[model samples]
Target: MADNTAAKIEADASEIITSPRVEVGTRGVNRVDTVYASIMDAMSNGEFPESGRLPTETELAQRFGVSRPTVREALSRLRLDGLIASRRGSGSFVLRRPDRNIKRFAPIESLADVQRCFAYRIALESAAAGLAAELRTPRDLDEIARALEHLDRVREQGTLGVDEDLQFHLAIVRASQNIFFVTALEMVGDQMRVAMQLSRSLSLERSKVRREVVQAEHREIVNAIDKGSSVEAAEAMRLHLGNARRRLFEGPQSE
Candidate 1:
C-alpha cells in the first residue's frame, strides 16, 4: 500500500512537470520570475501549509527541470522580497504572501510616461543625494564607487549600461542612510528600471560627445558627495537630471 501511494505521488509530480511551459524568456520575464510565480501558485493552492517548510533546493531543481543555480536565484529573490525565510541548519520556509499594498507605478507605455518618471525622480532623488552627501559613511562611499566603476566599464564596452546606471543611482539613495528614501525607490523599482532603459536607448542614439558630458555630470555629483557638500551635491543631481530630460526630448532635430 505504501509503494502504491509513493507511485501515485510521483505520477502527480510528473503531470505537473509536463504541463504547458510558462513563458519565461520574453522581455521582462526571466527564469527567476517564472520559478517564483510557480512556487507562489503552489502555496496559494494549499500544496504547502502556512508553517510548512519548502523542499530542498535539489528537489526544487528537479521539479522545475532547471539548474540548481536557477532555483537558488529564485529563492534568493523570494527571500529578499520577504516572501520566504531561511534557517542555517534547516531549509527555507514561506513567510507570507507578498504585500499587495506596496504602491507601484504604472508601466511606461510611452515617452511621456518616461518623462513623468524622471520628473518624479528629480524631486525625490535630488533630496536623497543632498542627504547622502551629509550622511554617507566610508562603506557607503565604497558601494557608490563600485557602481560607478561598473558604469565606466560598461560604457567603455559601448553598451547602454542601463543596469549599471540604475545601480549607481540606487547606491546613492542607499548612501542617504534614510530608510524612507530607500523604501520609496524600492516601491517603484519596476517603473524605475523601464525609465532607465528608455532613457539609455535615447542617450545611445546621440553623439559620443553628449555621452561624455553626461558622464562628467555623474562625476560632479560624486565629487560633491565625496567632499560632503550637500548643497552642491543636490544642485549637481538636479542639473544632471534636467539635462537628461532635455537630451531625451529635444536632441538634434531630424532633417
Candidate 2:
C-alpha cells in the first residue's frame, strides 16, 4: 500500500514538473497557498497512500520547488483543517479525502475572513468544551440537549439549522460556567452567524450522508462532556470545528 501510494505521488510530481509552470508569488499569490492547493488537488486525485503516510517535508519542499518552511506552513493548515495528522516520530498521514463535489458559495466576507473566524472558534470553543466537561451542571447538559434537539427538528423539516447549530455551540460555552467566554462569543455573534449560515447552507445542499456527519460531530462533543473527560472534550471540539471548516471550504461537491 505504501509503495503504491508513493508511486502515485511521484506520478503527480512528474505531471506538475512537466506542465507549463507558473511562477510562484506571481500576481500577488502566496507560496503557501500554492503548495496547499497542490496537495489538495493531489488528494482529490486519489494520490495518497493507503497507509496514510505522507511524504516527508524535505521531499515535499523539493517536489514543489519551495522552501521547507513554505511546505511546513501548508501542512500546518492541512492539519488544522483536519485533513491530515502529524505525529512526532512517524510524520504526517491523510485522515480523509477532500470532497470533490462541493458547491461553491460566495462568501459574505472574504474567504480569508471566514477562515480566520474558524481559526478563532477552534481555539475559543475547544477551550470552552474542555471547561464545560469539568464544570457542567445538569442544567447545562439540558441546554445543550435542547439545542441539539432543535437542530434535528429543523434538519428534518428541510430547513437549514444554522440558528440551532449556533445555539448548540453557545450552550457548550455557557456550560463552562464562565460568563466571560459567553461574553466573548456574544460579541462575535454576527460573525458566527455569517459563518454558520455559509457552512450550514453548504451542508444543506450536499447529500444526507454529509449532513448526518455534521450531526455526528455535534454528538461527539456532547458525549465527551457527558463523560466528564476534559481532554477528550477539547479534542472532540477541535476536531469538530476543524472538520466543519473542511466541510464548508474543502468538501467535495455533488456529482
Model number with the top lDDT: 2
Q: Model 1's lDDT to the true fold?
A: 0.69
What is each predicted model's overall lDDT from 0 to 1?
Answer: 0.69, 0.76
Task: Give a tens-digit lDDT track for model 2, residues 79-191.
Answer: 76667898889999987766543324442224435665787777778778888998999999999999988987877786987788888999999999999989988888888
- Clash pairs detected, candidate 2: 99-252, 100-252, 100-253, 101-252, 101-253, 101-254, 102-252, 102-253
Q: What's the distance in Å from true for residue 201, model 2? A: 1.0
lDDT of 2 at 231: 79
Distance from true location, Cα of 52 in model 2, Å: 19
